[model samples]
Target: MPSYYDIDAILTDSQKVPCTFEITVPGLGYLDGNPGEPIKEGTKVELPLWLGEMLAVTQNNTNTPTLSLDLPQCLSARVVNALKADPRVVDIRALAPHFYALGSRMLELFDEEELLDVLTDTFKRRAKEIADQAHHPRGVLGEGAEFLRGLDESERQLFRSAHESSKAVRNWMVDLKK
Candidate 1:
């Protein structure tokens, strides 16, 4: 399960989900299910709002959830490190399932404001399941790029672009003072 914030988006055409997300990773964006879908970088793309929230929530939280627009460098790294240090995760490193089986019961709730509550509850349950698996059965990505690699292509590309941009912003911080 992933955590989510209270971000809002209006529904667009059925073709485009209510939320749009632009992906900008050179080779990361591949519309595996939607054939011939153009992969655009440095541009805006609309995806289902639920998808965007998933990306957003996972990026923001370690175990507890917090919403901050700016990437929390130390915080994100701390969670990743904690997960990595966990004995359960380290021992299961060898199975390397390549992907965790997300419960089909999992569904993204968005496009309507009311769904947020439903989403909130769903996210908590899912997060608990994930944390459990982290501590016991099944392996995890250890809360970083390593964990992110476990994502499917579409989601992975989205994260890559966000991460790449965040890195650029972080690198420019020192120069910004000048």
Candidate 2:
């Protein structure tokens, strides 16, 4: 099954702005001697956004950090490009649920409505192409088909219609051969 979440995107966006962290161990001299007070074990300190994320990941048991981010609008464009490049290799729908959840939690996280609309439009267009091509005997459903399957209820309905149309065409061809 295809995953329906973009955890890396969420993590990246979440760590966009610098935030505070509670350190649990010592010996992180690299992050010390900066503008702010030196980071020490057992003390709370503020760190740069990227640094904080790195430290939190590297020193999981040693730091507890908070993050907030404003997801960039370009993300959707990137996704669209990836889908266009190889809809069979890219599952754009995988990001829908995560986008929805994150957008709900953080209104400013992303242009949720716009992203959803764009994704739906792109998926529909690509799915139609796939369906049309599917009538060929050798056509193979790939990641694009999986992406369509992962769509939300309404979007899935659209894919289902296209798929049904393709099926009908295939049956008609078989009847003609008979």
Candidate 3:
């Protein structure tokens, strides 16, 4: 579970997921942009993950779920295929700023083995690349600029940590020699 005050968690939960109403919801049309109308059954709407997950697990008067949630577009087949084909080339930051966090959240609601494997593999590959880029002294105008730009928030943090660690180690070596 994510910490309540974690900004990344908040942003990840704010990502939209497609939802289909399982039952008619009175005065809930505001979600679909109509304030006064009721949301009819089977109406598909894009809702933030937080609201959608709540509605998905909540039981209606008939003992049925209020709605069903679908995978967000960011995790659609195309993106998954792209990641599988070449994880390094996919610009995950453009898809979602908190891509890994969103994936972890979705995994709690879903039981897709392939998605889990793909995400884990993708993260491993990307983390290696990020570490390499961070350790290597590439000036601002050098290679890997595009790849760095495509890193999601977590990957950016990893890059920063690796870069700082490398610098600290170099400085320590200089001090030892002095």
Candidate 4:
């Protein structure tokens, strides 16, 4: 579970997801760029996860949800297939800054075993690359610059931690050598 003040969690929730309305919502046309008109039934809109999740899970008088959430385009088959082909090559940051975090949240709402597997494998593969980049002396001018730029928020943090730890260890070793 994400903390109440987790900025990454907030951003992840703010990311848009496609939603199809099961019922017409009156005076909510602002969501679809029309004011004062009801959003019609079967209308599809891209809504933020926070609002969409609430609307999706809420039971109306009929005991059915008002709308249904679909996987975001960031997690579409194309992106998944790319990751399956080469996890290190896909620009996950372009898809979503908090890609893995959003994936975890989606997995909670959806029962997708394949998505889980792909995400896990992708993370494991990219983690090795991130660690290598962190330990290596290749600065921004290095060959891995493009790959480093594609890392998601969590991976960025991991790289920072790994880099900092290595730096700290080197400093400690120098102090001991004195």
Backbone Cα, N, C clashes tallied per candidate: 5, 0, 0, 0
Using TM-score as the yardstick, the better of models 3 and 4 is 4
Clashes of 3: 0
- Kindly report which residue pairs in candidate 1 clash with one another: 1-126, 1-127, 20-46, 21-45, 141-147
lDDT of 1 at 1: 34
Q: Write the per-residue lDDT of candidate 3 for residues 121-148, one digit (tens) a residue.
A: 9999999999999999587778898899
- Best-to-worst ranking by lDDT: 4, 3, 2, 1
Model 3: which residue pairs collide?
none
Residue-level lDDT tens digits of model 4 in 60-100: 89988999999999999999999899999999999999999
Model 4: number of backbone collisions: 0
Q: What is the TM-score of each candidate against the true structure?
A: 0.23, 0.32, 0.97, 0.97
Ranking by TM-score: 4, 3, 2, 1
Whose lDDT is higher: candidate 3's or candidate 4's?
Answer: 4
lDDT of 4: 0.95
Task: Give stretches of model 3 more than 4 Å off.
Answer: none
